[model samples]
Target: MQRYFVQESHWQENKVTITEEDAHHIKKVMRMTEGDSLIAVHPEGKAYKVSIESVGESIICVVREEITDNKELPQQVTVVQAIGKADKVEWVIQKATELGVSRIIPFQATRSVAKWDHKKQDKKVARFEKIAKEAAEQSERVKVPHVHRVLSLQEVIEETKDYDFRVFAYENEVRNGANRKLSEHIKEMTPGTEVCVIIGPEGGFSPEEADELYQSGFTSVRLGKRILRMETAPLYFLSALSYEWEE
Candidate 1:
């Protein structure tokens, strides 16, 4: 069954009014009509089995049954990724959301080459947000992962001080044959603990940046023996986390 997310304002009594883009998707694209059943995710992440009550200019769905199931990681994992060139950031956001990350933070590392113009940051973030929402719905996630505003390395470090666990994927660590792995730290984490992992851009992080992160309680870890791209490393780490934590 298809799933659509609706705002709180759309809810009235037992029915939801779907308008704008979602209405177009149902009426024209999917061609779904009255009596069709679909899952509607509320703003608070509750899922309800809804039967299409009516469809025309808007989609009106009557709530049939409430779904108690939730597909999300027990731990809230935040991926702090350095802005990369091209559409790599979008690819990262889409794949990471599917892999069950709770939040994503784009960082401006010392060696990061792709710089977002201050004027267009909001627009770019909005695009990433849309990608995340669609990916979450397709992956059956209850809550959509949030795309945080881009921050400088110092700002990122300051913000992550409250996180329970932090690690940075440093290519140099793999080169040095560090035996420590992210799983080692993950295994020690309790449920509901927040984990943040940092990944560098195309040029990777500078030595000073790595040192600062390490000094601020981030474990310098390697994803694998082989080097992965800026976009691929975070996904790999998230997959490893899922393999370890998910039942």
Candidate 2:
């Protein structure tokens, strides 16, 4: 069944009102009519089987049942990705959502190639969020992962204070033949732990930036012996996490 994330105000009792883009998708794209069934995810992450009661300017659905399956990762994982090329960031947002990331934070690293225009940051963040929503629905995620506005590396470090564990992918580790894999660090994580994983840009982080992050308590972990691209690093980390916790 198709899935749509419904806002809290749009829901009343067992009925849900889906409007705007999702309504268009149901009416034009899916051509769904009355009595057609789809899943409606609540803002708080609850999902329900909903049957279309009416389809017109808006889609009105009646709750059939609450879906109990949890598709989220055992622990919350936030990807702090340094802004890279536009396409690469979009790919990360899509794939990371499918991989069950809880949130994405794009930051401006010392070596970031793509710089965010402060005036247009909201538009860029909105676009990233749309990609996340589409990916979440396709992956059958109960909730869409949030995409934060671009932050400075220092701001990101301050934000990590709330996370239970924090790690950054460092290619230097691979160069130094650091044997500690991401798996080693993540083994210390338990269910519901909040984790933050940082990925550098294409040019990678400068030595000074790495030193600062290390001082701020972000453990440097090697993805493997090989160095992954900026966009690939987060996916690798998320996959390893899924293997350890889900599989």
Candidate 3:
């Protein structure tokens, strides 16, 4: 069944009124008519099986059943990923959502090659947000992950100060043959805890930036033996977390 995230105002008295882009998708793209069934996710993450009641200017659907499936991870993992070249950030947002990330923070690191103009930051963030929403629906995730506006490395460190745990995916740590794997650090985190994992860009973090992050209480950990690309590192961490936590 097709899925949509609807606002609370759109839902009332066991009926959901789909409008705007989603309504167009139903009417034109899917060609769904009366009695057709689809899943409508509530703003708070609850999902329901809804049957089309009417279709015209807006698609109206009546709740058929409430879905009880829980597709979220036990713990929330926020990926503080440095801005990379091209659409690599978009690629990261899509795949990270599939792997059950809770939030994505695009960081402008000292060594980051790609830079977003201040004027276009809103559009850039909005684009990533849209990608996350679509990916969430495709992956059957109960909740869509948030995409924060691009932040500087210093801003990211301060923003993540309140998280239950914080760690950086350091390639240098791997080179030094650090005995501590990301899994080891994650194992110490209890279920329901929130984690922030920082992954640098293609050129990676500068020595001073790494030192500052460590000083800011972020643990520097190695992913594995081999080094992964900027876009690939976060997925590796998320996959490891899923393996560790998922039943």
Candidate 4:
């Protein structure tokens, strides 16, 4: 069944109002009509199985069934991903959302090649957010994951200060037994605790950036023997978190 997300205000008595892009998508794109059955997510609550009762300037779906169940990953995994080339970052957002990451933070690292101007950054992040939301719904996630505005290394260092568990994937830390530490770190995550993970850029993090993150309370750990690409790191991290918490 088709799944829709609507604001709580859309619900009044026995009907729900859907407008703007969603209404257009249903009326024009999908060509759904009255009596069509589909699933939906309420703005402030859970998913529902609804049947379309009206289709006009505004579409209304009557609540046939509502599901309060949540299918989010076991932990609150926040990926502080380095802002890379355009398409690469978008891929990260989509994949991360599908993997059940709770939040995504785009940042600039020392080796980052692309820089976003104010206007471009706004447009870019908005696009990624749309991608994230669609991916979330497709994955049957209870809540949509957020894609935050772009930040710099300094900003990320300060932003993650309040996170309960902070980690960074660094090859340098391997000499310090980074792999062993990653294994041990997995055993320590609390079920619902917020974890902040810092992933490097295309060319990877500079020594200075890595060191600064470490000083900011982010534990530098290794993903494995082979270096994962900038886009691949977050998926691996979220998968590991899922395995640790869910499996």
Q: Candidates' TM-scores?
A: 0.97, 0.99, 0.97, 0.93
Quality of model 2 by C-alpha lDDT: 0.93
lDDT by residue for model 2 over 38-98, one digit each (tens)?
Answer: 9999999999999999998999999999999999999999999999889999999999999
lDDT score, residue 159, model 3? 91
**Whole-structure CA lDDT of model 4:** 0.82
User: Which lDDT tens digits does candidate 4 get at residues 1-247?
Assistant: 6677787888887677889888898888889998998777876647888889989899888988777677888778889988878889889899999899888999877788888786787788788888987898788886778888988888877877887899888866654554374657877888878888989888888988877877777887888667788999889888887777777
Pairs of colliding residues, candidate 3? none
- In lDDT terms, which candidate is top? 2
- Compared with the true structure, what per-residue lDDT tens digits does model 1 show for residues 4-110? 88889999989999999989998888899999998999989899999999998999999999999878888899999999874999999999999999999998888
Please name the candidate that would achieve the greatest TM-score relative to the true structure.
Answer: 2
How much is the lDDT of residue 186 in candidate 4?
A: 78
Predict model 1's lDDT versus the native: 0.90
Report the candidate with higher TM-score, 2 versus 3.
Answer: 2
- Kindly provide the TM-score of model 2 when superposed on the true structure, using C-alpha atoms: 0.99
Return the candidate ranking by TM-score, descending.
2, 3, 1, 4
Q: What is the overall TM-score of model 4 with all chains considered together?
A: 0.93
Give per-residue CA lDDT, model 3, range 28-124, as digits (tens).
9999999999999999999999999999899999999999999898888899999987499999999999999999999889889987788998888
Clashes of each: 0, 0, 0, 0
